[model samples]
Target: MMTFKFARPLAWLLLAFIIFVTVSPIGERPNTVTMVDVDRAVAYLLLGFAFALAYPKQWKMVAMLLIVGAFAIEYLQYFSPTRHPRLHDAGIKAMGAALGLLAGWVINRWRETKAPNGLPFAER
Candidate 1:
């Protein structure tokens, strides 16, 4: 049974990075990345997955944060001088979040199976 005390901090760091990337000026980004919508989704997917791992006991909060964060970031983009908000991006973000949640669930289940204590048993 391995422990990951670093997961929370790393997840928060990644969340901040995602926020920076989202709000920064378009010209500030590198030219190498293509498929803007897909990229946004993938970034959010990773964010969601990381947060899920970090807060395994608070999945509802994680879900709300991911959803709200995705939409809020896109909404805030309207104020950016070089960026305009798009619902399309939000849509892709939702899809990515869903997939990330599923991945995290699977990872957590595997972790529980491998742990000496096993998964938490519900109280009767």
Candidate 2:
């Protein structure tokens, strides 16, 4: 399957961002103008997507790590003076990560099915 040259590096960058965001004070966080839940979900979604693409052969492990990392993010927030951790929030993040992983799976499947003759898999 075709893979992006920088997928792994991007994933690492995202992981670092996630940690930074979690630890930073609430007032320091960027204003996305969206609901906090939406922000949390989308962040984890992107993180999972990167990891999935970075490690195409390890999607299952990526799913597990991302989910665990979601909960871990919440747990980390508890140590932050201005942040609070919530199970509901973690759940949302986990769901988003799952969706992201599914997206990566779809992309990989599509690329793998590309025909040798430069046509769609079905046309081959």
Top-scoring candidate (lDDT): 2
What TM-score should be assigned to candidate 2? 0.87
Candidate 1 C-alpha lDDT tens digits along 8-118: 887789778877777889887555375887787787788778777777777678888788778888787877899888888887887787678668767876777666653
Please provide TM-scores, in order, for all candidate models, with all chains considered together: 0.85, 0.87
For candidate 1, what's the RMSD?
3.0
lDDT of the candidates, in the order given? 0.75, 0.82
* Model 1's TM-score against the true structure: 0.85
Off by over 4 Å in 2: 115-124
* Candidate 1 weakest ten by summed lDDT: 115-124
Residue 8 error, candidate 2, Å: 1.1
